[model samples]
Target: MRVLWLSSIACNGNTHSFLNYPYMEQFLNDFEFIYHPVIDSNYSLKEIVTETIACDILLIEGSISDEFKRADVPVVDIITKYAKIVKKIVTVGTCATFGGIFRESDYKDTTGLHFVKEVKIDKFKDLLNKTISLSGCPVHPEVLVNTLYAIKKSVDLQLDNFLRPKDYFAYTVHNGCTRNEYFEYKVDNHKFGELEGCMFYDHGCQAPFTHGSCNKILWNEVNSKTRAGLPCMGCTEPTFPKSNLFGTKKNMGIPQDLPLGVGKRTYLTLAGITKAFTIDRLEKKLFDD
Candidate 1:
């Protein structure tokens, strides 16, 4: 398959994530690159982005901005050109999937390819059926590789309403976290630098409510932000990087946001039961080092 990477109003974080794909050579062997910003390619930026370029898969990164121009031509124009020819469009980050963090500046002006923050863009409405979204701040490399492999194998992927492949996004980042034990016991870490507790109750760790199997797939084959004492920040969701990212918003001791699909009363009942216990194992620090 011929794949081409396109950047809109972007920082190229997804491209960096793609470059760091663990099985780089194996992935490259399966696809032909017509043009890629970071990789050596047969075509130049101008040629690859033109209306006539052949592309089996168009991988888009970054949020679409009406103001962004490339050599006097709007990025949206290039997107229109490619969208007409590409067999399938893969929006590789939350930016191109759901108008991510970049949209905070001007949400009305920035948007994703098909749906912009859960709403569809009528201009590119025809492309919706052909689009696949892999939403993340900097998309996980494994998802990119696996999605490509699935397409190459012609395997049908179970997709969510957002057009994201369910195989990778079905589970939350909290699904395989080491801190699951702490979360289960309602033992939350009040501070930022402690590894002995869960960040869900106190910190703005939205792993339980956010989609994406970050903990299960792992980042750098080693760690995730939540595992490294940082909160999940809900990068995969439309409302990511919420105003107060370090602290969880509570209204009368109840978190403003509950876990995905969980009712507030149900959560409170479970929380109340769990909070009754002070498991010594969870409260005790493992090591000073």
Candidate 2:
């Protein structure tokens, strides 16, 4: 299948993320890459519009803009023209799938490709069947690779309400986190770079509620931001980088955000019971030779 890739209003973070795949070159062999922003294929903005690229699949990166100019052409119009001919449409990043960080500042002028502020576009109603959304700040390479493989194999994929693949989005980042023990014990990491406590309580981590397999699959194969003592940042969620990202959300000195579906009262009660036993093992350094 010939895949056409386009980007607008982005820093090419997704492209970089995909490049991190250890076997990116081998994995890409399955499909015929006709055009991409940074990879093998090359095409200009004018060429993308005029040339009849036999595109069976279309992958879009970055947020769309009805106001901004690119190569003297409106990006939204470019997307609309291509969406008409492609058999499958994939929104590759959070910006393309759900109007990410950029939309926060210029919401009225900027929006995602298929959906406008999470609302599906009327003109694209017929194209919904072909649309696939892979949302993440800089989308996971595995997700993109797996999705492409599935498409190449003609396998039927399941998707959630937002059109995200069910397999990847079914589990939250908390499902297999290293700090699960700490979370169970209600132990909170007061500062960054600690390996002994859960980050949900006081470190601004959103692994429990947000969907994605950051913990299970792991980032860079060995560590994630959380494992290194940094917060999850809730990059997978539509409302990422929630206010005061540097600080935790608290209610009366306690964490405001609970695990995915755990009730506040239940969580607090469980927290109280767990905090009673502060294991020395978790408090000590993770690595000691």
Candidate 3:
């Protein structure tokens, strides 16, 4: 399969992240990249801009705008031209999937291939059948590779409401988190870089509700943010890059956001019960000097 990667109103973080994929040799053997931002491929970007490149998969890596142009050519024209011909269209980050952080500012007209922060872009409605969203600050490379293989084999992928493949998005970042035990007991981390408590109660952690397999799959196939004593930033959601990211927003003493499918009342009841008794092990540092 031939893949063409394009960027618009982006920082090219996704392209850099994909470069870190451990199995690049294996990935390259299965698919051919017609044009990539950094990697030397079959076609140079200049050539791709002027000519119609035969692409099996069109990978868009950033938020787009009618005004955003590449090599003096409108990005919309390039994307739309291929959207009609490609077998699959993968929007490869929160930016391309939901108009992400770029849309938060003056770029009001910037949008994803199919959405603008939850609002559907009617212009691309016709391409929804073939478009797949892989949302993250920088999407996990494995998920992208797996999705590509699935597409190659004609495997039916179940998608969520956001049009993300359910195989990866079905679980929250908390599913396999190292801090899950602390989360279950409502033990809160008061500071950064600690292994004893859940950062969700005090420090901002959207893992319980944010969809993606960060903890399950692990970043770089070894460690995740929570594993390294940091909070999950919830970069995959449409409302990502929320203000005051390090602090949890609360109503009275209760968190404004609860875990996915979890009710506020049930959470309060559980909080009350869990806080009443403290587990001795969780109060101490995992590695004491």
Candidate 4:
């Protein structure tokens, strides 16, 4: 398949991140890479701008914009040209899938391919049948790799409403966190820098409610943010970067967002019961220490 990497409106972090994926070497050999800004290709920006490249799968990165140009040619025009020929459009990164951090301060009416923030875009009717959104600040390289492998093998991936593959987004980050015991018992991490307790209460850790396999996949194959004493930032969610980064929003002491598939009333009741116990073993981040 002839795959093209088209970008616009933000940092090319997804491209950089994907290049470092463990399966990158395998992907390089598997696909016919037509054009990429960072990777060497047979086609140049001049050729791409002037001619319609035959594309099978289009991998678009960065936020979509009308004004952004490459080789003095509008990226939207290039995208449209490829969109007509490609059967699958894999939008990598939150910028291309959901507009991400760029739309928060959009100076050029920039938006995502299929959805603008949380709403679907009527213009991208082509994506209705062919779009696969891998939304993350920088999409997890394995997620992108596996998605490609599945496509190459003709595997039918179950996708959510946002076109995100459900296999990765169905579970919350809290599923495999080391702080599960602390979170269950209602023990909270008082401040940052200590990897001892859960960051859900005082800190704005949205692992429980946010759907992502970050903790399960493990970034860099060594550790995840929660395991390294950082909050889950809720980057995968559409309403990411909500007002505060390190603080949680509450209403009468109840978190605005409850855990995945959990009801608010049930959660509050469970919280009250869980806090009633005093298990010293759960207090520490490590059991042996």
Candidate 5:
């Protein structure tokens, strides 16, 4: 398969993150790269913009903008050209999928390839069927690589409303979180760098509501934000880079965003019941300090 990787208004965080993939050398061997910004490839940026290149998969990184140019060629023009022929279009990060952090600058101008923060982009509405979104602050290397292989094997990836592969995005970040028990008991972690309490109550952990395989797959194949005592920032959601990320938005001691499918009343009742009893083990340090 041949891939033409392109970027628009972006920091290239996804590219840097992808370089950390343990199997990158093997992946490069399998896929023929027609043009890549960082990697040495068969073709240069000048050729990609000037000539018609046969590409099977078109990987777009960063958010899109009308003014942003690559090789002095408009990014939208590049996408419009290749989007017509590419078999698949993979938006490889939250920025490319839903405009992410860049959208905060100018919601009208900076936008995703197909959708702008849940709103579909009419210009590329015709290509929605062939587009796949891999939304993350900097998408997990495994998720991107695995999806590519699935595409190679003709696997029909079931996507969600966001056009993200359901196989990876279906699971919530809380699924494999280590502090699930603490969350259930409504124990809030008051301070950072401690593994004793759940961050959902106070530290703005969005694992319970946000969907991703961060906890399941683990970042760098070792630890995740929650595992390291940091909160899940909900970077994969359409409304990423929300204000005051360190503090959970609440309404009179109740969280504004409850766990997925869990009603506010039900959560309040459960929280009251859980708070009635104390789990001595949870209150004590797991190991002697």
Candidate 6:
């Protein structure tokens, strides 16, 4: 019941996401909450390294680095020391579970805390069985809450190849999307903020191919970035923000990436057919100012 939360080389986006949980306060009541970066009952990095706290669970945030220097000490060494005593370890956020955007920089020398881009490290193999990964640009709050609840209750939890819980990531972002109707009819939104057209074709939205339930759960209990005139950006998928996010990928006038299992030829053929029969409603504004 004693949890030791830690972070390294991150902007604290996951912490912010967890704070937005509707039932966060209620859900947290189940655990002792021994330690966290921005919550009750926590310790500083210096205190953690000094072995001042004894914990049963280790929750890591942000990417790991072998050479990351913090106050003249390496964070990787600090985490490994705690990993030795903890019964369970949870890597929160894509940065901690899988090398994220921060890894692009040289100084941080960042990589996932456990498996570095699908490649596992032997140093942490002994603790793999106790490890649970919650990956997202900033992990969804529900994912963290549900995982903790499952562990505390000692219930069986299903996980995928990446060690992520199945319940939350079982479906793609395309599932239950409001713009699904437009996607089915091959309607493409030529510009940002159009509610009636799909963003996959011309706008670089990755909802169809990316996994997660942004559309199903709905962020802030109202809408997601995609639903409110923004694109999915594939924040949950491994290959996120693929080079030059401002534009879509195309190879020979066709989208370089297709929906989950869609064939390139089939997608193009359908797109051509749908483009020929442009509906006036799809082209006209759905809301008036």
Lowest summed-lDDT stretch of 10 residues in model 2? 104-113
Model 1, 57-123: lDDT tens digits are 8888888887876656788888888888887889989988888887765535888777678787787
Residues 1-289, model 6: lDDT tens digits: 7777777778899888888989866867766666677786766656677664788778888877877755467777767777888777888888888777776757445677666666766656777788888888988887787788788787778877778777888788888787777778876665774566677777788888877878788887788767775668887765654676656688987878788888988887988888789776766776744
Candidate 3 segments whose C-alpha is farther than 4 A from its true place: 105-108
lDDT of 3: 0.89
Candidate 2 residues 143-251, lDDT tens each? 8888888887877899887788988998888887877888777767555655677778776888888888887788768887777767788777667657877567888
lDDT of each: 0.84, 0.78, 0.89, 0.83, 0.89, 0.76
Question: What does the lDDT read for residue 102 in candidate 3?
Answer: 86
lDDT of 4: 0.83
**In lDDT terms, which candidate is top?**
5
Model 1 ranges off by over 4 Å: 105-108
Cα error, residue 4 of model 2, in Å, equals: 0.7
Winner by lDDT between candidate 6 and candidate 5: 5
Clashing pairs in 6: none
Which candidate has the highest TM-score of all? 5
Give candidate 2 regions above 4 Å deviation: 105-108, 116-123, 287-289
For candidate 1, the per-residue lDDT at 217 reads 82
Q: Estimated TM-score per prediction?
A: 0.95, 0.91, 0.96, 0.95, 0.97, 0.89
Off by over 4 Å in 6: 42-44, 69-73, 118-123, 272-280, 287-289
Ranking by lDDT: 5, 3, 1, 4, 2, 6
* lDDT (Cα, 0-100) at 134 in candidate 5: 99
**Model 3, range 103-144, lDDT digits (tens) per residue?**
754655888889988888797888899999999999999888
- lDDT of candidate 5 over 152-217, digit per residue (tens): 998999999999999999999999988888888887654787867888988899999998999999
Better of 1 and 3 by lDDT: 3
